[model samples]
Every structure is written in structure tokens, then in C-alpha cells.
Target chain A: MKHTLSVLVENKPGVLARVAGLFRRRGFNIHSLAVAPTENPNLSRMTIVVDLEGKPLEQVEKQLHKLVNVLKIQDFLPHEAVERELALIKVHSTKETRAEIIQICDIFRAKIVDVSQDSLAIEVTGTEDKIDAIVSLLKPYRIIDLARTGKVAVSRGRK
Target chain B: MKLTGAEAVVKSLELLGVTDIFGIPGGATLPLTDALSRTEKIKYYLMRHEQCAAHAADAYARATGKVGVCTATSGPGATNLVTGIANAYMDSIPIVAITGQVATSVIGTDAFQEADITGITLPIVKHSYLITDANEIPYLFAEAFHIASTGRPGPVVIDLPRDVQNQVINFKFPEKVNLPGYKPTIRGHTRQIKLALEELMKSEKPVMFIGGGVVLSNAHQEVKKLAENFRIPVAWTLMGKGAFPDNHELNMGMIGMHGTRTTNTAIMNCDLLFAVGVRFDDRATGNLKRFAPHAKIVHIDIDPAEIGKNVKVDVPIVGDAAIVLRELNTMIENNNLKKTNHLAWVEQVFEWKKKWPLKTPDSTDLTPQFLISKISKAANDKDLIITTGVGQHQMWSAQFIELNGPRRFITSGGLGTMGFGLPAAIGAQVGKPNALVIDIDGDGSFQMVLQDLGTIARYNLPVKVVIINNRYLGMVRQWQELFFGKRYYAVDLEKGSPDFVKLSEAYGIKASVVSSVSELDEKIDEMINHRGPYVLDARVKEEENVFPMVPAGASLDEIIGGD
Candidate 1:
């Protein structure tokens, strides 16, 4: 099973390395990670998606808590949080296929951010599954290049 | 109130109640050393190497229960403290290591004596700081000390640039540290404690698996009470030696590989594992899947990561060992749960203990085990503090040296660093000036840091240094003989090892050699009675193996050389 943990750590130097080093040392498998400064300037929020493969997620969170810079960890269950990933896919587009690419982006509520003589850059922001659907739809057009901002999430609550 | 960063550091240390420090002076550390010298309250022990200094500081912290401090110059000096720092980190000792960096202007410009000490030590330290401004010194030192000494304690590094040390600032020490990310849980959850207590009450064959946390939390009394009042057998990890009375009736001795067969057997058959202050380290667990196979583990540790990281835990109480154990003991006492007795189980454990004890032949053929037994018996002080270097001698000491209280037996349990004993004894002696500190060392282990004997002689620490000279890397030799079919690769220490007696004498310390069992007692007395530091080289039979050996990764039940 996969676990998505929201870890808030002090915005000090080497904190990311400290957290990452712990994971590496403890043999925890991480699927994807995203980090950015939070609303509080002194703290950074890291969204870590790890597949523990039956290794208790509690153990990983507990280990992360041991890092001095790590302040708090809130694990988000799939239903309780809104998750998104931003991906820019450059697809091989011709004069005939440009309209089809634009149509696919419109249907998915994604925008075409860039266009080239031989390729079209499509920027998509949605849940991982939605992005994966869009990317697969454009697979026949041949993806020339792709950039993905793995995952970022927030809890869906008033608090 | 304005003072240089160096002066501020010294003042802060004085206020922190740091009475002694161990280190060598270098260019980056010159100002700090000068400031330290001006302080009459703190005595500094000049060490031969920065590694020795760190080891000394670590052992001092273990003995004194205060945060130990060590200093070194940047680059090589800072690097030298890595093994010692790792050792302390592994064992959860509280130590503050201060390293002098190049001036901030030349920090990354490849300046001489410059190293990224903070970056290098990041993975090993609890927290680290690189002084950017002189103003950060007082608060940073306070925070460093706080982080070092509090909750699951470990080493913290403070990298101070020389310019910061030279900068003048108004220095007023802060009374409190405000680290939003650094709060440690002191008390275990109430419901978890109740569940643990229930498990204790319901168990018919409970075994108390103790670890370094007991010594770290000073919870030996609580452990002893729980074991005695409840009639439960106890088995301790390497770090847990001296955390309980070694000769007690319920004592199953050390656990895991090379543990007594009795302890291994008890763990094999136990129904409930009341593990307190233990990390479930692989060395103690043997094969984790089969460890306490029939038991429901109730682990109590301040670090929650330690509880379920290695094995499946039934209940985990994350809090200080002393706090949690005291609560459990009080709760059990108040609830009248002491009436639950496992007499048959206790008798079964005792039967195993008697039948599967570590064997020592009664021959006079100069064995390490005999020497350790004779020394422990001959020592007069009830408060004897013994430290040992890594290898066969360490295991022999762990087996033969019977200590009555916590903080009495200090060894390199976690990292198993070989050169730890001498400097550790030095640290222990300095920390408890009146106590008899002895370093049970091996030839291979002693030769690693014998230069630090000069530190002992200079301070007249009166540490008894007993070198068990087996003329081989005995543990490795044993391994080669057993696992590798006696190929005898590089296990010989004969050609390169020093004449330990002459080596000690050259340091202006008393020295002697005892090669036979007849001279063991007299030589031990002479070494102990000496006013200053003394070294005894006990030439023992080579190629002896530690037992009862459970081969690495094997189940606890598959032990060899028992009885």
C-alpha cells in the first residue's frame, strides 16, 4: 500500500537532506516527493509519497519525527485530501494533428502553454490519474519531452 | 557584556555546568582554547587526537549524565571525530562537538584548515549549526546543548568560523531555547501504559528485554523492581549491561549473538516481551522474523521509530524509559498486579541459566575470561567503572565483569569501535574522579589509541588499563576459523602489535606483564594500587572464540558452544 505523508519541517538548511537521508538509510521506498515553503515562512511542507510494501507507515513517520528540524507529520488518506500534479508534455504535432491535440487539452481542462513548428507543449494540472489519461491520449502523437512536478497535496478541511 | 564568540562560548559552557572538556588545539580552535584556558571552572584535558577527544567526551557523558563536550580544528581534525561521533550517535550518548572552521570569508574558498564539518556530520548529529554571526553563538550553544542532552540524546555539532569567534558581541545567555521543531515527548500515553500493564499482568512467561535506554534514562531501579516484584526473568542487550544486577537470580545475561544460551533460550520461549529502552537492533534480535517468535512485544522507547522499525510490535509506548517504567511500576503496584506469579516459568528460566551458562575451563592456561573474572573480583570499589575496547576481550568483559549498578560497564556497543576503551576510561575517570575506571582492552584494540595514555598520565587519571594480549585479532580469527574454514587470512596481530607494557611505561605510566594465572592477582593488585595510571598486559591464549555463538542472521535457538 502507498502512504502520502504531509511533513512540515523547519525551513533551515539541509532539512530536506536530513529527511531524505533518513529514508535512504532506513530502506524506505519513496514513489514521489514534492516540497515547498508553507504559509508559515519558518516552515516548509513536504508531500512524500512512499510505498512501504507492508512496512508500517507509522515506522516511517516516527523516524521522520526524530529529525530535529521536522516539526509535524500529517498523513493524508486518499479520500481526505486534494492532490494534484503539474505536467508539461511536448508532443510531436503536425499541421493536421494540432487541432486534435488542442481538442484533447480542452476536454481535459488543460491549456496549451507552448507551440513550436514541429511540436506543441501542453501544460496539464489535475489529479495523477487525470494527467495520466491525458498523456496516454497524446501517446500516438509521440511525446517529444515531458516534465512533471511529481505531486503536491492539501487536506480538505476547514481547520 | 560584550565578548568575542570564543569568550561567549566559554562563558556559555560555564553556565551550562560543563566542568571538563577533551580536545586538541589547532589554528581554527586557538581563540576558543585561549578563552577556555581563562576559565578556572572548566578544566580541559589536552588529548592526542581529536578522535580520542570525542571518545573521551562520549564516555564522560555516559558516566556523568551530563552533555559531554569536545573540540577540534576543521578538516582533518573534524573528520577524526567522525567515528567517535558515530559511536555516540549509535549509542544515544549526549555530546556536543564544537569544531573551528576557517573564517567565513574563506570557508568555501579552499582555505587551509577548512572543512564542511556541519555538512559532513549532518547524518550523524541530532542537530548541527554553522555560526554565521557572532550573535548566534550564545543562543546557538544553548540550543546545541539542549538538543544534545534532551530526549533520545545524541551528538550535536557546532561549526564556528574563526572570524565569528573573533567578532565581539554583547553576550547574554538565554535561559530558554525556542525550537518549534524540537519538542520531545516525556510521558507515554496513558492508554498505552494501561495496555502494557495489562499485558504484564496476563503473561505467564514474561521476559524483560532491557537496552541502553535503561542506562540513558537512569531507570535501572525501575527495571530491577519490575523484574523482582513480578518474578520475571530479564535479558539485556550489549548496551544494557550494568543496567540491571548481572548476578541477580532472574538475570538471563546478555542477549542475541554471543549471548548466554540461557538468555537465547528464554527469548525463544518467552510469551511476553516487555522491552524497555531497546531499539530491537539486529545484533540483539538475531533473525528478526524468528525473534521472540511466540511473544507479543510491548516495546517502550522514547524514539518511536525504534519500536516497530525492526520487528512487529503489539504495543509501543513512546516516552522516556524512566518516566514510563516508573509509571508502569507505580500503576502495577497500585493495581495490586504483583500477585500474578509465573513460578514455573521463572524456574524454567533459572534451569536454562544454570544448564547453559558460559563455560570457562578451570585450567591455569592464561585465558581472557579468567583474567576478567579475577580483576572484577579483585577490584575493591563498589563503584567500579569498566570500559572495554571492541573484540573478544570486550565480550569476555561483558560476560565476566559483574557490575551491581547502571553506568558501571561502558563499552562501544553500537558502533563497536575498537579504540574506544582507553579514551573512554580516561573520560570516565575524569567524570567520576574518585571511582576506579578500568579499560579492558585487547592488543589489536589497545594499539588503535594508545597515544591517549599520555592524556591519562598528564592528568594522573589513575585509570587501570588491562590489555588482553592474544597476539591475534581474536574475533576475526575466530570468525575465520568458524565461518571461513580456518584460512587465517589477516587476523594475526603479532608482527605489528606493540609491547603494551613498554608502551605504557614510555607514557610515564606504571606498567607490567602477567602471562600466567598465578601472577594475575598480584599483578592486578599492583596495577590497582598504583597512584597514577597503570597498564597490565595479560598475555592470553590466542584464537579463542566468544560463545554461545548464534551465527549472524540465524534464529536465537540455533546457538553453538553452549554448556
Candidate 2:
């Protein structure tokens, strides 16, 4: 099962290595990981999506709790959280298909961030599915370059 | 005095006389490593893997009596060290593993890379901790070392957070550790000792069974004095191989699965079995129902949990072996146990020793058994230490090697860990450099921690490794042949073994090979006499098995002995 874990860390050197090392040593696979600064300056939150079954995840969690640098770990379910992925897609828009690309972007609520003579770059931010849907729609226009920020997620509301 | 987690770690190294540490850097542990940067006295070893780091530390601990130290970052890194820690715990080696943790404020909130390493390691450790206060660091460090090195020593882990490491406080290493929760009883009850002596004096057929704790307690002298005073025959468990010198007139050799026929017979017939510092393991006592059927056991150990957990005892005393033995010595004189002499039993034991003397087979070629004898001769008592990996070589060492002192013969008896020899040899060598340390190991066992040769080379430790290159897991095969109708499973290792001499050469250790029995004496002499680490690969018979074997599931009487 692929599960997303949001971990708050001390934002120090070797912390990533330690986390990666633990997973590697245990033979657990991480599908995707993105670490970024949070609201707290001293703490950095990392979102890790791991493909592991029951016992190994529990074992990894237990061992992670042993590390001195890791402050907390939270497992976020897909259904409960508002997840988003930002992707920038550039399409081959030679004078002819630029208006059609703009029209499709408007339908998806995506904004045209940059325009060159031969290409149109669109920035889309939504649930991973929403971003993928827009990227698929613009695929027929001849996609030039594509980049994505892996999944970022948060729970539904404050208690 | 108060200290930060960083300085506390430094102070701990100073206390343990540790010149080096093995670990990697991480968030929670950064402050400690940063502090280490300023220290000239201690050097840090960075390992590619955290598990390897723990193994290196374990090896160091087994080689040296000092607590072997290793560190890792939070969560995964800390988790990687579990196997090595468990290995140390099983073998009862003294090690201190330090790991970084997530800060206290967000500890349970699933912080980045944070793990509950202390909780995970609690079951495997003698003691473990999570220091929230900066002032607690010094005391905890000292206590961890104390707990690790003293009594029945094992590994302890101290989890440190980034906040604890960063906190500033006046640091002074305490002269004494004052942990109220862990007070190991140093002295045994005088009354209990008196009762044990009375039991010894009254019994006509009393046998003394010793364990590894005798060596751990450094009570060989006391054990010897009591044995001589009572004139009782001594038999040992696998761990207690060297507790009593095997060459002694009263020694019946090791008593268990591969024990001598006479020892097995004596154990079954003895009226009182004085088991000291030895856990009654299953291998030692095949079927508990029939184990020591004729004898009333007197079990003495430092760990209370181990007392009733194994074989039940009529009399149990929980205290330090050395302390208990000392008290027992005094009580014996008062109770007149000294006045009683068992010349008849001594004569019987001597007769048995003569009948079942461990003699080398008449082989012109250099044999593994003969090679072990040569190693033992080179070791020559005088505080010499010997370590062995599990297999034919281990049993050969147990049978042929004479243990003149306690703790001098070190091996992983309970776990039967193959890779134990080299690392343990390192620990023993580091612990006593003046003492000649020899690892009488098998090829199968030596390969497990072959990478540790790097540690030996880096440190320039003079550890003599005698590799019995039989090219097989001799013990497993022996059992398979005897019990499983000759079905050879994964026991054979004829294919993958490196040219051992060349491998040793690659590791920068002086290497030698004795393919023939004719070359055994001279080659072993050269290897042992060399001051640096030397590996001597002695090619012995492949089919040789450790004998006088007690067929499993059979009674003690059903032993297979050489005619």
C-alpha cells in the first residue's frame, strides 16, 4: 500500500540521510518524498509516500521514533486530506493553436504564466488528478516541457 | 556538573578511555559531532552503513572490555542498528549506542525522520534512556557506561534530541554514577553462602558446574579455591569452557551436547550439582525433565530473571560471581566445608580424564585440531585471550584448548554466532593489548565479519586470527549426517571461499597457509610470534565432526563416543 507520511524534522544536516538510510536498511521503498520549510522556522516538514505493507511500516515508524532529530510523524489518508500538485506544462503553440490552448486552460482554471513565439507555458495547481487532467488535455497541442512538484497534502479542517 | 548532550558524549569517551567512535552525521546528532570536532583526544569513524557501524562497535566491545560506542541519526538510521544491537545483546557484549531523536515539542507529531529508537531497543538493552533535560546528559552518559561495563554487561542506548545537544550548561564529569533505579547487588547473602557450603560439605558426590559469569566476574581464582578445598570434580557449560582449566586433575571437561562421556555420566550421577554463573541453557541440558535427574542444583547468578527461568534450583543466590565466591570461601571455613575432602570423587574424575583424554588423531598432515593445540600452546596462560566463531573450530578449541583463567576464553556460546570470532578478537585485543589475543575461527565463521579487518588494520591491533579453513559449516553438517540421514543442505561452502591467504593480504594483514600437518607447528609459531594481526589458514579434514556427541532427544546415557 502507498501511504503518505508528513514528518516534522529538526531541519539539520544528515537528517535526510538518516531517514533515507533507515528506509534503505529496512528495505522499504519510498515512492515520492518532498521536504520543505513549514510555518515553524526551526522545523522542516517532509512528505513521504512509501509503498510498504503492514509490519514494515510499523517497524519503520518505531525505529524513526528512536532518532534524535525527528520531531514527529503523521500518516495522512488520501480521502481525508486536500492534496495538491503543481505542474508547469509548455506546449508547441505556433501562431495557430494558442487560442485553443488558452481556452482549455480557462476551463481548468489554469493560468498562462509565459508566452513565447513558438510555445505557451501554463501553470496548474490542484489535486494530482486535476493537474494530470489539464496536462492530458494539452498533450494534443504537442507538449514541449513538463515539470511537477510531487503531492503536498493537509487534513480537511481544524477541530 | 551540568553539560550539553554534545559535551556529555565527549566526557563519556574520556571516561571509557575511548579514542575512537564509529557513526555517521545527522540532524539530532550534529551538535555532538560538532563538539567532537574541537576534541583532539577522540577520533570519529564514519561508516557507510549504520548497521555496519553498530557491528564495528560490537566487534570493538568484544575485543575490548570497554563499552563499544556507535551513533546514528533519527528514525531510519537508528532502526538500522537493531540487528547489530540485538547481536550484542544476545552475546552479552558491552556496547553503548547513541542515536539522535526529534525534538521534544513535536516528538509524537510525526516529525521528519524522527523515531522512537529507545522504545524499539528497550527489550534488547540492559538499560535505555531518552534525556529531555540537558543536565541529565552527563549523569546518563556516565551511568550508561557504568551499566554497560559492569555486572553481566550488555548494550545500552541513549537517545539524544537536537535541543538537548544545543543546550548550554556547566559540564563536569561525575566521579560516581548515582542511578537509584539500577543498583546491581555486589555482595551475596552470607547466610546463603554458608548454606551452599554446608550442602557441598555434606554431599558425597558433588559436581561443580560453572558458566560464563565466572569469567565475567573474574572469579576463576575463587572458583578454583573452592573446587580444590572441596576436592570436587568440575564440568562446564559451553560458555564456561575456560572457567576451570580443562587440564586440571578434577576437570571432567565441558558437559553438554558435545561434552565428554565421563562428564555426562558424572552429571547424571552426582548428588549435588553446584551451578555457578551458568545459565542452564537447552543445549546444555537436552531435556529439562531428565536433566541432572540425580542431582539437587545450586544455581548462582547476577541476573535474577535467569535464575528460575531455566532449570529450577533447590538453592539460588543472585549476586556478583566474584563476590558470591568470596563470601562462599569465607563461609566454607566457618561451616567446616574446608575440612571435607572428596579424594574418592577426585580419583574417579582423574580416571575418567585418563580414559577419555582428548588426543590428536594420528595424521601426518596438519589437522585443524592440532593447529588449535599449537595456538593454545602459543597463548600460554599469562592473561592470554582466545575467541572463536561457531563450528568445528569452536568445539575443537573448547576440547583442545586449556583455559587457565576466567574470561580468557571468549566465544559466543549461547548464540553460536559464526562471525563472532574476529570482532570479539578485536574487542579482546583492544581490552588487553599486552595479552596475546587469538581467534581460533572456522572459514565459514570468519567470512561473516571479514570487513572488520579494516578496523584491525586502521587501529594496527595485534590480533592473531587462526582460520580453520575446512570449507564447510562443520557443525551443521555433522548434525545433518548424524540425525538427518546424510542430507547436505546449505552447509557446504566449497565454492565461494576466497584464497584466504590472498584475502588476508588484500586486507593488509600478514597471512600464512599451512596445507600439510608437517607445516602446522612452524607456521603457527611464525603467525603467533608476529606482532601485528596475522591470519593462518590451516586446511583440516572436511568431514571431521565434534564428538563424544549426545544424540539430540536422547538421554545423557545415549552418547556416541570414539571406541
Off by over 4 Å in 1: A90-97, A115-120, A136-144, B380-382
Taking the tens digit of each residue's C-alpha lDDT, what string does model 2 give over B204-273?
8899999878867777888998888878889888777777887787788888888887788888888899
Error of 2 at B504 (Å): 2.0
lDDT of 2 at A73: 78
Task: Give me the runs in candidate 2 sitting further than 4 Å from their true place.
Answer: A1-159, B1-4, B15-30, B40-66, B72-80, B102-115, B172-180, B334-341, B381-383
Give iRMSD, candidate 2. Answer: 10.6
lDDT of 1 by residue, A1-159 (tens): 888889999898878888888888778888889999988898899999998888777767887888888988999999999999999999999999999989999999998888888999989999989999999999999999988888888899873
Per prediction, fnat is 0.74, 0.00
In model 2, how large is the Cα lDDT of residue B104?
84
- Give, for candidate 2 chain A, the lowest lDDT window spanning 10 residues: A59-68
TM-scores of the candidates are 0.96, 0.73
lDDT of 2 by residue, A75-134 (tens): 887877777778899899977888999999999999999999999999999977798799
